[model samples]
Target: MSKQLDESEIQRLAAYDIAHVVHPQFHRADHDGAVIYESGSGAVLRDVRGNEYIDGLSSLWNVAVGHGRRELADAAAEQMAQLAFSNGYTGYANLPSIRLTERLLGIVYPNMSGVFYANSGSEANDFAIKAARYFWYTSGQPAKTKIISRGEAYHGSTMAATAITGMAPFHKGFGPEPPDFIQVPTCYPYRCQWCAAKPGCTLECADAIERAIVEAGADTVAAVIAEPVHGAGGVIPPDPGYWPRLRQICDRHDVLLIADEVITGFGRTGRWFALEHWDVQPDILTIAKAVTSAYVPLSAFIASERVHRAILEAPADAKFMIGCTNSAHPTACAVALRNLQILEDEGLVERARVMGDRLNAGLARLRESPHVGDVRGLGLMAAVEVVQDVATRAPFPPSAGIGPKLARAMRDRGVVTRVKGESILFAPPLVVTEEQADRMVDVTGDAIDAVTKGQA
Candidate 1:
């Protein structure tokens, strides 16, 4: 067991964090009261104060094999002792990276021919954008430069990825929006403006992408990027027909489809990859987060055979001019190989499917509450949307601060997860037990009742 921090030490560290750490999505008020996590094992985390809480969001939806895995540590140490680092530049190569590439290609879409490594999802996505443009530039269609993304999408925080992200808040204070990035309507079934009143889905959301492609001129659009199941913006799973239609539209326009699977990849959504749920494939796929279970920083953008061939055939000068310093860090690759082995050997992908059903079933009972407007998810990923009025699906005003209130309430009850706007997202580790899954829903229900009891 690891040594525990004393009370004074904890307070000192918290103060240091407030003074130094520049957190992501930082808010000064929230940072002041931040809980200092010290250790985690399986689906539970222990704070410096030693209070345990269910890791409902898998620490930002990454730790798929769960926390405190000695196997991964051993793998990393073994690789580092053998060969810590290697230049993955053009001429040099490493064994672990090459082996991982082979393993990933075998499991990912059959069309994928190669992988380019990066350190984070943002970098992987930026590379995807660049690769898409490069493909068209070399194919005698230099004008194909624009990238279309859907509203409510969260690609990453990099400048190029930020422009591709459709959420308005991400663009605030970031100067004028970057050019050549277009936004279209999202396929959010609950809040879909196009078909909310209709008897059923008109799939007008998919048609909107087609409209955007035409409006931009097909020759100017290089690709259409999207998440298989939208995370962060909300746990909004696209309608069954949505992805297939989007794939058809991209093909019709000769636009490369880039699936940002940073959150949905590696068995988070039942299957090995969420796109497999729809039988649709993307030309370029950007993945991170669960790749190494966040053991170390690693990510990659994969290219389909068609896209790889185009870059390969390009002249030496135009030869996909992009590379990262840690392109294929051998240590990270070894850890990832071991992580993939654990995922496969333990059958966590199918386990996510099983536990996801249990989780959804538990959350389904929350529909009885007046504030619970929607419960939707795929596999182990789910969300409970709180509403001001159930009949109209009206959201609470921002000033009401319902999301933070509910988040605090759940945290106090030993259940911690993401509460974005009116959506309460739940994506526990695949190793979660039925009991832990039940606690997530039960605590959420109790929190909703406690927070919204007398509200009109």
Candidate 2:
């Protein structure tokens, strides 16, 4: 076991992190002075200073079963002892990986016939994009290679996945996005820019996709990729009719649908997969994060039989050969299997639904506050959109830095969360209790009031 570090030691470690660690998706200047987290268990995390905070974002929307699970650690140790380093690249298979694939299929939708392994959500999405392009190539429709994602969508960090990501910040300094990846409007109802977005108004957000499909021409489009709930893009759940309409549009246009379930998969949204809430099935599905509860890196790119048949059943000479060295790592698969078992045995999915209601209700009460514009989410995944005026729905100028202010206040109050622009995101571990959920909501409300007291 590791001993607690003294103040001097913690300062030294923070300095080292500043000098050596290149934190992803963070402002370099901020990370240079960021807090150094030491360890965590259950829904709480401790910084190097030994201050505990409720893990509101589940440490990047993973850790579904919570932190420091001994069963998962034991599973990893046992698998490592038995066979830690088999190369799936050379057609060598390991027991844990084999079992993980079987287990995933048994729990996932029936159409997901095969699983391709990777190391992260980004890798899974990258592979899914490649698989879609390869599927079209093998089907003798090479021109059908364009992928349609929504504006403000986030896929992953890799070049191919980055190309699919619709968030402008991720692509700002990156060179031109890869060819044939197009972005359409998102089905975000909270801040919908298209129309009034009230009852009886047309779902122009969904219609925008069909328009993009027509503009690209059906034959030129390969797939429509989306997250069930746009997590990184402000936790915006889709309009009720959005996903089913997208599914119908994809089918009508012969475009494959790819659900990027990295954030919403594995009971985050009160369902095994967020798409299940709408009963909408995608041709390709990518999963990560909660797969191993973030204990071990593991991701899966699952394909329907149609996609599988198109690629795997191709002639040997025409097969698309692609894989990573860490694909199907036995130890990671073992940890993930154990994590899934815990999620099932503990009934965390149903728990997420029940407790999530409490979380959302508590958050909804905050809309009575002056700065709160909206409270929205499904299950444990949710957000509170902060604005200058709830009546006018006017967002505070980025110059106000309300997001950063609220984040700091919430941290001071012993709660950790993610602030995306004007939206404060909440995705606590599925295992979080109702009391913890209430605490998280209370902290969020206090943060909002403390930050927006004068302005609001």
Candidate 3:
């Protein structure tokens, strides 16, 4: 914790890490050794041992502009000197946060008037949930306290955010959950719960909400939250008509639609926001991660004018219901503003579109491989679903640890991929070149082939 250690020294320290570091979501029964990263640049990272690897997962779905961008570094440094820390609470304003809010709202469509800042995606989504409740309370609809979210969704780790998350395992042992949070089916066409295919299926998946509302009682539900493209929960992009139907359903039931744009925002989906691809906007949108390309910890919970007006018209005592110490940190906001400027001027969104198409096609060619079951994605976010047998869609036995094995094999070959459930996720920095995109596909193809063959 004193002077920075050399590689060998770091590895020794890493040895201690293995003995002590309890990484989240890891299978502690067999995981050994610390994975050490040294440094990085435009689309790649190197280990302490000097093994360079493509940053295929963009350091957990952030890193939009990629590593070692001096411009971002310089921006961070300058802001630090001028105003290291300032809270934008109680009508206080800082230049960076004020400017960042204006810039963010500009990219958003149909005009969002207010931006609520937080330190991370989890916190941002947490704020959105609280704000929804606060807005309804302010409007004299105190009974509208419940929130409905989709199964197989990822919001964040905060209690309120996690409460709305529909994934069951994330809630195991930690609950005693809050009242009024409910779950409904996800529009995952690949794993549709209602088996909604040609069999009155298109709207069936989305219509489950109608059932949920009927059961939960429409008056009790305040909002329904979803990721236009579910990121951590298997990168699920809803079916063709799924989102549009949800928009109509929410309108009919008087439930506010909250889009969790934490992962799909800022060109990751080839659009400014993934919902835009579906031409669906939400009453509230929560964003983080790529907002500043992960150069700083910052997030925004945006409100459409309807939601904005509801909050604005509230009596004076609502007290800015939710904000943290770092909510709109001046330095973080300054970096975010500059980051968007770069994304705009460089046309990175267009680049993500062209390169994503090329990579998805390249991956589709490998579907013949036994282990490749599904390749699905939009823009920079992609996933390869591995199965034991594609014909039956049989998963490897739970005892086999198939996902971690394949990921480690890919790592040995100098590419780092993220294994989520049965899928290997690929989300490189948006600045990745076409050749690098091909390399990402090629390396994973090789890894998949080897892992399946080895298991056989």
> Over the stretch 203-255, how does candidate 1's per-residue lDDT look in tens digits?
89999999999999999999999999999988999888999999999999899
- Lowest summed lDDT across 10 adjacent residues in model 2 is found at 194-203
* Position 1, candidate 2: lDDT: 20
Model 3 spans > 4 angstroms off: 1-8, 19-22, 26-31, 196-201
Per-residue accuracy of model 2 over 373-428 as CA lDDT, tens digit each: 98999999899999998887899988988888888888889898888887999999
Question: Lowest-scoring 10 consecutive residues by lDDT in candidate 3?
Answer: 193-202
Question: Top model by TM-score, which number?
Answer: 1
Residue pairs of candidate 3 with colliding backbone atoms: none
Name the lDDT value of residue 49 in candidate 1.
Answer: 84
Candidate 2 TM-score versus the reference: 0.97
What's the lDDT for residue 378 in model 3?
A: 90
In model 2, the runs with Cα more than 4 Å from the true position are 454-456
Candidate order by lDDT, highest to lowest? 1, 2, 3
lDDT of 3 by residue, 102-126 (tens): 7888898675778888888888888
The local distance difference test score of each candidate is: 0.93, 0.88, 0.83
Highest-lDDT candidate: 1
Clashes of each: 0, 0, 0
Q: At residue 65, what lDDT does model 1 achieve?
A: 94
